[model samples]
Target: MSFLELSLTLHARQQERVELALEDLGALSITLRDADADTPDERAIFEPGVGELPLWNEIVLDALFDSAADRSGLVHALHELVPGLAPDRFTFREVEDRDWTRAWIDRFKPMSFGARLWIYPSTVAPGADDADKIIVHLDPGLAFGTGTHPTTALCLEWLDATDLEGRTVIDYGCGSGVLAVAALKLGALRVIGVDNDPQAIEASRVNAERNGVADRIDLHLPEDFPRRRENILVANILAGPLADLAPLFADCVEPGGLLALSGILQGQEGELLVRYAQWFDDLAVAVREDWVRISGRRRG
Candidate 1:
């Protein structure tokens, strides 16, 4: 069946009320986007820290409805739900249904990071030469980190270059367990994966099993995670949380252990270096596109 997509640009302040109204009016799904996306005025709406909610100042709210639904009725309802909503601002079009799963699978072909590391969907088979390569089998899921994002790629490349043989690794904020599995595949003795989101833990478990690293990686929620010194610690999370957990992260690494951090914008390196310098030495930064990765050694 086809669908009707109704969209309207609204101030960020009006999102909650308008979303509720759309749900009440039989919207099958509602999604928000930045109205200035792809423009010079585009903004970044990053993941908020615990108990914080951050959204774009101006948002494009899109609600999908059944094709037979009354468009005029939706507009009138929205007007009542949000006073002063402009009628001309409402836009909608019909969207045809297709195999979204296959489409996504088609787009996510095998991706390589560094020299020996590769990430591919389970549906795809590795090439003959890949017998010598370290492969990560991951299917897209609700959780993030498929090694496609620059932040995740940087961490994966660092793991590839590091000698993980017989080393204990900590993958803090382990989204989808990509880093944990990669470390294991690269010969780490043990790996611990921790994330605040339960879905992330589940995704990590599934990905680890897919990559046959489930036996080597232990996945847990942040509160349930055990603290310990490791030979290496990698966190592909935002710079803000990285700085906030500086002491805790420092404590997780053994003296002279390696620390690899990503999910930072280019200009944010200095602040992070200063934050981590208290416990780490030989700090260095690498850049990919607009993102930055910082690596260091735990001070002895």
Candidate 2:
């Protein structure tokens, strides 16, 4: 069946009301994207924490409806929902239905991190030359961390270079359990994956099982995670949260244990270093694109 897609560029403040109005008017689905995406003025907004709904200052809201539905009714409802919304800001188009899952999978191929680590969707098999590769089987889902982002790639590469043999690792803010699963497959005795989002926890579980390391990984929501010192701790969260959780992260690593942090923009490393210096030593930094990975050892 064909669908009618309506795209509206609106101020962030008006998003909720418009979305509700569209839903009331029988929108099948509503999705949002940053209107300034990929531009030099792009904003780096953190993923919302649980129970939080944050939007960009400028947003492109897309809503899908049955093609046979009343288009004029939708426009009228939107006008009433947002009194000052501009007519020129709305665009309507016909969308043909296709297998969206297959489309997404087609864009994701095997991606390599460093020399030894490889990430591939479950739909694809590794080549014969990948016999010695450390494979991480992941399928794109609601959670992030597919190793496509520079932040994730930096962490994955760092994991590849680290000697995880018999070490207990913790992946703070574990998304899709990619890093934690990689650690387990790389010989970590056990790994703990923690995230604030329940969806992320579930995604991590599924990815871990797919990688055949579910038995070696323990997934948890932040509040339910046990307080224990790990041999190595990695957090690929943004710089803001990394700084805020400095003490917590420090406490989770054993004295002299290693810590690796990513999701930091190039210019933001200094602030993080200063924050982490209170509990860690020998801090080093690695850069990929505008993102960086910082590693250090917990001091006694």
Candidate 3:
């Protein structure tokens, strides 16, 4: 189904505010992109928020026009959602997705994580498999993660290299339950994927079953974080969220257990390390492309 594509020109600080405002108005998925493609470091991201409302429907267009007439409403809402943003600094426009959103996965391919592990959706898994490799099958859904992104890849690779045989692992922001599944594939005795989003929990469960590890990897809500400490904790969420979740990540891992994190920009490494330092000792950074994956062990 075609979706209404909305675009907004927002200042650095105003980005989240605008996105939240749009979300309140019915956006399902959003991407932040630079206004100018040639300028990669221009302090902007082309954010796309998708809604189920079809763009071809004139009724949806009419509502957009009506909403645009009172842009101040969104502007005011932004100021409330995010502080210190001058509403006038933001501009909004609406476009038709015209199938552009669905194409985001066009480039997706079977990804091999670690040295010998491969993950493929049942429909996408290559017909021929190397006898030596461990292959996992998964299907795409609306969940937040896929191993295709560097952030997810780093975490997957780490889980691959770690000796998880019979270890208990927790995936803090289990997107498609990919990392947890990976851990199970590596021989973790038990794994669980946790997320606040119900969709993520559902997707993770289904993906776990698809990979033949549903029984091994349990799904839980973020609030229902298991009381037992895990042998390993892996969180591949954004830098800010990871920092906020540092204490929880530390608490979840058993003493001497490792915590692996991704979804951080290169420059944010020092700050992240400092935040995690209070809880985790001997933090180390792993670089993949321009992204940094922070991994460390919890202090007793």
Off by over 4 Å in 2: 1-98
- Report the alpha-carbon TM-score of model 3 versus the true structure: 0.69
Q: Rank the candidates by lDDT, best first.
A: 2, 1, 3
Q: How accurate locally is residue 180 in candidate 2, as Cα lDDT from 0 to 100?
A: 91
Model 1: pairs clashing at backbone N, Cα or C within 3 Å? none
Candidate with the greatest lDDT versus the true structure:
2
| lDDT score, candidate 3, position 277 | 90
Winner of 2 and 3 under lDDT: 2
For candidate 1, the per-residue lDDT at 232 reads 93
Give the range of the ten consecutive residues with the poorest summed lDDT in model 3: 54-63
Compose the digit string of candidate 3's lDDT tens values, residues 1-300: 334343444444444334433433323445665443445465343323432222211111111222222456445534543456544445566655344423444434577887978887554645554677877775444565666556777888888888998899888888678888888888999987888767678878888887788888788897786767888888876677887877777778888999999877678789999998988887999987656799999889
Cα displacement (Å) at residue 55, model 2 = 26
Model 3 lDDT, full chain set: 0.67
Per-residue C-alpha lDDT of model 2 across residues 129-217, encoded as one tens digit per residue: 88998888876554546776677888999999999999999999896788898888888999999987676788789888887888988
